[model samples]
Target: MSFQGYLKTIKEKTGKGPEDFQALATEKGFVRDGQLQVKATEVTNWLKADFELGHGHAMAIYALLKGLKDQHSQ
Candidate 1:
């Protein structure tokens, strides 16, 4: 699936968008001021355990959290 597809699915499943996740990540100390303070594995692990996301899907969210734009945006 495309990156946006993954993001869409994640929003459907989690009821949260990238901005929402960023807020939660900040609350969890995973991010600070829109920057990732933890390792990708740590973020992936959190997503896996809490959101039940697979690696690729979790990575898609991770990419967004790290300030990467969707390919379609380019």
Candidate 2:
């Protein structure tokens, strides 16, 4: 699926927005200078275990990295 599709799916599943999770992640120190570690598989595992994110939500971040999701970055 596309990045936006992943985002929309996550929103549908979790009832939250990208910024919502971004903020949560920021509060949790999962980021540094607006970047997370690349390692796609590791990221997915982290999301599932730490953030309770499912496949779709984890894929949203991947899509963002692949330039398939939101183009704007904070």
Candidate 3:
């Protein structure tokens, strides 16, 4: 799937957009001051365990959190 497609599916499954996940990531200390503070694995693990997201969807959120991707981008 495309990057945006992953984001759309993630939002559909979790009822959360990138911003919401950013907030959650901040709360988890995976993000700090709008920057990612941990490794991708840690962030992905949290996403997978908590949201039941598969690796690809979790990585999509990770990209958003890490400022590697944006919600509207393809």
Candidate 4:
């Protein structure tokens, strides 16, 4: 699936958008001042445990957190 597709599906499943995830990450200290403070594995692990997201979906969120992918991308 495309990046946007993945994000849309995630939102449909979790009722959360990238901004919401970012806020959650911030609360968890995974992100600080718009920068990711943890490794991708740590972020993915948290997503998996809390969100029940699959590996790929978790990675998509990780990409967003790390600035590797943009939430507004086409």
Candidate 5:
């Protein structure tokens, strides 16, 4: 799916748009400092349990997070 499609799916699951959830993440420092290191398996499980996101969708979220993190690094 395209990036927009991934974002839409994330909205449905997270009940918030990218900016909204991202603001929360930023407050938590997930996108601060430099590197973005997270437990992929843990995120996968959380998405599955909390949002009912399938593997592909969950992976998309992971990609989006990584992308956003990268944007802050530069």
Candidate 6:
């Protein structure tokens, strides 16, 4: 699936968008000052455990957190 497709699916499933995830990540200390402070593995692990997301799907969010918005823009 395309990046936007993944994002759409994630939002559909979680009822949360990038901003919401960003806020949650900040609350969890995975991000600081809009930058990711944790490793990709850590982010993916959290997504897996809490959101039941697969690796690829989790990586999409990770990419967004890491400021790769160009690809996410669709």
Per-residue lDDT tens digits for candidate 6, residues 1-74, read 88999999899988988888899999999999878999999999999999988899899999999998634487
* Worst-scoring 10-residue span by lDDT in model 2: 65-74
Candidates' lDDT values, in order?
0.84, 0.65, 0.89, 0.94, 0.61, 0.89
Question: After TM-score superposition, what is the CA distance of residue 9 in candidate 6 from its true location, in Å?
Answer: 0.5
Count residue pairs with overlapping backbones in model 2.
0
Task: Please name the candidate that would achieve the greatest lDDT relative to the true structure.
Answer: 4
* Pairs clashing within candidate 2: none
Looking at model 4, which ten-residue stretch has the lowest summed lDDT? 65-74
Model 1: CA > 4 A from native: 70-74
The predictions' CA RMSDs to the true structure, in order, are 1.9, 4.0, 0.7, 0.8, 4.7, 1.4
Which has the better TM-score: candidate 3, or candidate 5? 3
Per-model TM values vs. the true structure:
0.87, 0.60, 0.95, 0.95, 0.60, 0.92
Distance from true location, Cα of 68 in model 5, Å: 7.2
Candidate 6, superposed: residue stretches over 4 Å from native: 70-72
1-74: candidate 2 lDDT, tens digit per residue: 55566676777867877777666655655655677545667667867886688877787765564445573443
- Which whole-number lDDT from 0 to 100 does residue 58 have in model 3? 89
Model 5 agreement with the true structure over 1-74: per-residue lDDT tens digits: 66677667778777876566445545655555533356567556756876788888766656555664322221
Relative to the true structure, candidate 4 reaches a TM of 0.95
Model 1 TM-score? 0.87
Query: Which residue runs does candidate 5 get wrong by more than 4 Å?
Result: 23-34, 68-74
Name the candidate, 1 or 3, with the larger TM-score value.
3
- Model 4, 2-72: lDDT tens digits are 99999999999999999999999999998988899999999999989998999999999999999999998
